[model samples]
Target: MANHKSAMKRNRQNVVRRERNRSNRSRLKTLYRRIDEAIVANSPEQARQALQNAVPMIAKAVNQGVLHRNTAARKISRLTRRVNAFAQNS
Candidate 1:
């Protein structure tokens, strides 16, 4: 219901941004799940590799404004901790 031209343009932009953010978030969740699965499988090497891949993806998400820097840092921290713990155990 955006009547003004500028408002219509803004609405269009919002739709695009929403989709982009959703895709990024979905990708992040997938990456998190992969790391979790690797950890549960008790493969430290695989978990480590997944974490290595995830960290940069997470940073990119933060850079793209899909995720906050603190949130990204927190996720990276927890994932790294889990991977490190797995390494210590195995």
Candidate 2:
């Protein structure tokens, strides 16, 4: 219940941003799952491709303020490491 006009406008903006962020997060999760599945299935090429696709999206999420820069970096680092390890092992 935003009584003030400005508050109401801000609330509306918040709702839009919340939904946008939610979708972005869901997409990221899907990408992560794809990578994880590829890893578990021992498909190096598929895992690498999924990691490649996810990195830029993660960065974009950081740029869009949906994720912190450090958080994005950490995620990218972990995914890359896992993919690299799987590649080396296979």
Candidate 3:
């Protein structure tokens, strides 16, 4: 319960931000899954494209403060490695 007017406003802002962050996270998950599915299907081109699309969105998440810089870097690194390995093997 936010009794103060400013506190109430802050709470409202938090709710909005929370929903936005959740949506961003959900989108990230979907992007990740797309890459994984492409890899599993052994479609190197699709996997590469998915990685290309995902990298920018991941960076955007970091820029938006939805994800930490290090976390974003780790995710990009892992996904890149997976895609590269899959491409090389295929």
lDDT of 2 by residue, 32-83 (tens): 9999999999899999999999999999999999999999999999999989
Against the true structure, candidate 2 reaches a TM-score of 0.97
Give the per-residue Cα lDDT of candidate 2 at 49. Answer: 96
Instruction: Rate residue 22 of model 1 by lDDT.
Output: 98
Q: How do all models score by TM-score?
A: 0.97, 0.97, 0.99
Best by TM-score: 3
Per-residue lDDT of candidate 3, residues 1-90 (tens digit): 999999999999999999999999999999999999999998999999999999999999999999999999999999999999999999
**In model 2, which range of ten residues has the least summed lDDT?**
77-86
Q: How far is candidate 3 from the true structure (C-alpha RMSD, Å)?
A: 0.4
TM-score of 1: 0.97
* Model 3: worst 10 consecutive residues (lDDT sum): 33-42
Give per-residue CA lDDT, model 1, range 10-90, as digits (tens).
999999999999999999999999999998898999999999999999999999999999999999998899899889989
After TM-score superposition, the amount by which residue 29's alpha carbon in candidate 3 deviates from its true location, in angstroms, is 0.4
Candidate 1 wrongly placed segments (more than 4 Å): none
Please give the lDDT score at residue 30 for candidate 2.
Answer: 99
Worst 10-residue lDDT window, candidate 1: 78-87
For each candidate, the alpha-carbon lDDT, in order, equals: 0.95, 0.97, 0.98
Global CA lDDT of candidate 3, please?
0.98
Model 2, position 6, has a per-residue lDDT of: 100
